[model samples]
Target: MATYPQEITLKVFVNKTKNCVDFVESDLDFVDVLLSFLTLRASLKCECGGDINTSVSYDLNRDDVNYEEFRGVFIKGAKFVVTDALCISLVEDLISTLNKCVNGDRNHMEVRLVKIKREQVLRILKRSLISDTPLTDVLLQNGEGITPKFSDSLAGKKVEKKVIDKEKKVCKLNMVLTRNKVLYAVASQDFVDLIFSFLTFPLGSLKKHLGSRFRMGCLNNLYGSAERLRSSGYMTAGCAERLLNPKLAPYFNCKNQVIGVEEEKEDLYYTCNGFCKLTALYFSCKSHGYSPYHESNQVTLVDPKSQLGGTISSHGSYCQKLMYMVTDELVVTPLSLESVVSFHNEIADPIKTAELSVTEAEILDVLAVALTSNTALTDAFLGTTVGVFTSVDVKGE
Candidate 1:
């Protein structure tokens, strides 16, 4: 069930009458539950059907489902059909709600303590950096994983014919960006959290951010080919297309000094929509002008949603409301330390910071071991989240 829905929520109906709403874990498969959540058309089956062409509706947001409630909903929605984009959107929203709940909810939950060795954390960090795979994939592949375990696969479904995937599997990261410069990077929501985990110290301290500025040295594996990534909604339709050709590029300003915005009626494609924005936040920078530091260019980790449907500009506390700009949670530049200070000064809030230095140190260690020994990165949660008294620690970022 969605922990909290901003507006419309998943609803259910039986014979033109609203039944129950939101997520209810019944014997029914989760997907079937989602389909049943919708109000069925009149022609759909119903026990108390007054007419075959009528409909019923149902939605509820009371609290967690009880076993009894779960059983009933399961039986009722057993034969429900109709799975479409709406189901996908609801699922996406539900994912967000779960994140908020997991982060904030503590009621009726037991307290637990977890202690993780620095070595375990460092191992995972190094492996991802060296292999160019997302950290999650590194952790999941188990024992020197050579292939990415993160990409999804629809098993049993034959992929439709494709000109791109069928051709030589070109690693887009191999294309160096000289004539084409990146205006922005869009990461999905899960990626955002992963990047945050990397940027922030695992152990808690008073510090809010890791580091204000550092150079992005990894882009080879992270940059999904433009078209493939856009379909996921991290960016607009033309984003990858425009970048492929500099003359038509819409991301940058005329002088190529700044980025432009992709506007919609109310929603802006400035930042990522959600899901992978954080992961997308880290770019595999292959642009010609890519630099560790640019005196004139300033970078800030942007939370696109913070703007309240506003544009993104390189100004303000979180950042000035420029056009709808997509950004990851952190930004780095080769700009001088003074430039880094100036970049923070523009912001209105004093936030938690993470330092890239710690990550860099891990990278060094991992590279040393990898060169001589095929040491791969691996990590695991040392404790559970269900607890009343929870203690968190950091190994010093």
Candidate 2:
């Protein structure tokens, strides 16, 4: 429950020898902001900082936080110095340039304070993704430029229309193809619900589902190390589990999360210290009995959506019974004929279309593509190198 200021200050340690940022020192609030990257739903064709460690604990009562103590995970008064080794390359060039000109103390290390405002945090969150560096690639000296260039071999490729007649029908993606690339795809509610659920996924859950091969900077190493530590009995109870396979916060899960990320359930109950009346109305506490009138002892926990004495609506996250248009870049909007026509106009005369029925496996593939590539639809369907779902029943139109 830390209240973040409009601007948060970070103390960065620059190593002159390595020409990179050794780590960053900041309060818990800064870490909170950085952790928001895992919840991004859309893919932004931009670069960002780096993946951060998400295992730190926070105090619920802000007053109990010892600002004076220099803790192992987070330092207090002098700013929590976190050795965020991941994605240091993104800032190595800036550090290298500064190392040459800036004169510093004897330790071959320079300390600099960088102030970031809420505006910057919002901007970063708007464009942030889970696997890639959170810092923009433009900051690095040899950054892999944004929007990976499509290979020439993909040009003039065609995807023909296909239909699958099965006893159990699932959601389908009507993909518009121009040559080798997917111009866009028309997704139904079920598929769109799955995509929207990505925004609610925790970093740990994503890493767990994607597996260790899921490379996004140094996150794989960090997650792997945590797993090893946990099995070795080196980590605190529930620390590694929370960091490695975190469940979505309450009420974050949608109806069709084929990625298998689970949601956290709240089942805490509270009653009065002294029990007298209202014991018959509710379950009696084993120790203190039940006292609904005792306001001081009773703790009420209710779902925010169902506080008014009704169950949560069964409706999924997105609008119901609507078709959505999803671009290769993961831009999702309402499907319309005008937009479809405009997309068709962009493609040359030799345009082809494909209809694909996506099950859980294909949905998982889409999840993988969304995390790693900008051209999610194209890569999921047409990329020869990547594993494409070929066994799906396809009827020639």
Candidate 3:
């Protein structure tokens, strides 16, 4: 077996509080204790058969920690850098010490160690070695280490390689989308577009418009063109919309409702709508394993009345009026009584329509997670018969 050098670099962020004062205060002394522990734990043998190289540095200015603070730790200034085999050892020792302190079961009198960097070890070695001798030569001569070697047969060999074309991999990812996934895709997008597209209509107008195959075809064509532009990384949905439907671009603003006017408020509505529409179109195209512009594929439907409760004329004008009157209350309401009655009679009359679709989905998700933890179930299912049982009994007399 060939061995390779494993160089690990880590940043330790220690916040000193009333609870953590012991670890931060008397920093150098605490660090020495930590270095001693790490030197043993890491099994870092020094070239000169002496103690492992390590260093300590501190910063006292306490400020709020944010993403910028993290960036500043490396960019603006680093408190310290230590490079040596013992660096990882020191980190492990400090973490163990802190874990014990936080847990409260361990004795507070136990010597607490502070973490140091691996770079510090290398710096110490570089300075200690003779100026004329190379660092690698010094370490090797002192019995520290040498480069590992692998057999030529193992190191270099010709094998079949599989290349995942992004175009194809993206297509595979799309195949995971089902109708429910499509709905999620839509919701994840710009809410403003959804409101404008579905809410402003004469209640059911949006549904009626969207439910039609012809309107769907138009959307598919438009989305297909947009997808091509997007795949080429040339234009975004808003950009494409402006390029293709320049006339409609003026009406695209949901908030201001005025052309050639810019507002201080972000155009969240339109931005959201564009994102939703683009995402839905992208996933729909991907699911079918085809480019959005594929001539044979159809546009995915967005059923506003079914998905989002709006006034549907078939549910009756009286019912529609009731919906508007009780819109706030109906927001939390279950699908309407009329719709429920219509569903049982008109949709699934003879068929036993149990609401197990959601349950089935949940079961599938659980199974996926379980399979990751327990491989036996997967192995058993591969070659054996596993019967699926139903809760409901069919005792036909």
Candidate 4:
């Protein structure tokens, strides 16, 4: 019985014309050796500066590769220059030659193992290497890196390893962070918003140039968790606790005492793409294979007790708001409140009318200190001084 020849299409792009040429796969595939086709001396004129042809074959043991000679990378399935016409002829001839040779003979054909160009190799002595260069730049005199023939297998692996992995977690740095390099700022609305904006560019930057490369978290644990993340190529910035001024404590208690556990984490994912700073931490912690929080601080914040005493109460409770603008802005019209609650129950449960004032200078002083001081906003920023869970959990994932 006789069998019909099987056909498979192989696509190749002509550099000069930016057009594709398809050939039968078996006709074009390198069966025994590539030199068989190089013997044809097909000169392909590419848009690149020099000629592209696969005539230069380097032997690993005998050949000393001057960096100039080894133009492209040595990855599998890497392409070299062959003229459009030459490539066409090789395919035709190869098919014809295969028609005569025993089918199993090609499999048994042996050649010295020259090199695996694209691999992770370690040198016993010394070698300098640049990665992911295109064949056009290598074989062709001035071959551009953008030749369609370049197969970016290494590039794909790089992204999978470095970029994609980073996006999946909050990074704990391999390097140590010092106090001087540590910046602890209260989670002002601007900073909270910055965290939100950072999330918008989880895998990439929203605007080119310098993209956001940090995570967001409540200012609750800046000294511990957030700092670790920031030092290790990650930023987990968020709101600080309360602005602990004796005069402002009562008003702050009224403004920020509504924060609860669920709302604390909801901010991270409210507008984010299903990821939060904790989500990143969750991944990073999981990867470490040990619970970093297992031996960590107790996860709770008692109610914020005012130094002035009895005048303020609401510790252990989450802040009602991340930050309240206690500083005043001048208003021409007298504002009327539908309802106002005073700290003193004896004065009345609700005050029908309310009056408030803060000078521009006072406003600037309070906000500047709150936004700048690392310690002022801790109570309000993070209700739990530490964290709730001992470590990251998949939660059904």
lDDT at 120 for candidate 3? 38
| TM-score of every candidate | 0.16, 0.56, 0.16, 0.15
TM-score of predicted model 2?
Answer: 0.56
262-363: candidate 3 lDDT, tens digit per residue: 112212221122233333234333333444443232233322223255432211111121221111111212235664344335422122211111122221
Please state every model's RMSD to the true fold in angstroms: 24.5, 9.8, 27.3, 27.8
TM-score of 1: 0.16
Q: Candidate 2 lDDT, tens digit per residue, 1-397?
A: 8965455666666666765555665565554444334332222323232322232233222445564452323111323333433322123324554455455534777777666655455433433333233333212222344542222222233222223344233488877665567777888878887877665666657778866324354444345545654465444444555667777666666665665676676444545556333333454654553345444344554444333565564333555668899998888889998997787666654555667767665566567656656687876676432234333322222
Pick by lDDT: 3 or 4, better one: 3
lDDT of model 2, residue 381:
72
Instruction: For each candidate in the order shown, give its overall lDDT on alpha carbons.
Output: 0.25, 0.53, 0.25, 0.22
Give the alpha carbon lDDT tens digit for every residue of 1-397 in model 4.
Answer: 9943322122322233322221223111221122121111111111111211231223233133342233322111222222222221223335555444324444443222112221111110001011122222322222223422212222112111113322222111111011111112222332233222221111111111111111111111112322232344222122111110001122122222111111122111111222222332343333323444432222323335333333333332222224322211100111112111112222312212111121222222222223223232221222222233223321211
Q: Would you give me the overall lDDT of model 4?
A: 0.22
List candidate 4 segments past 4 Å from native.
1-179, 211-320, 324-397
Residue 74, model 1, lDDT = 18
User: Candidate 2: lDDT over CA atoms?
Assistant: 0.53
Best by TM-score: 2
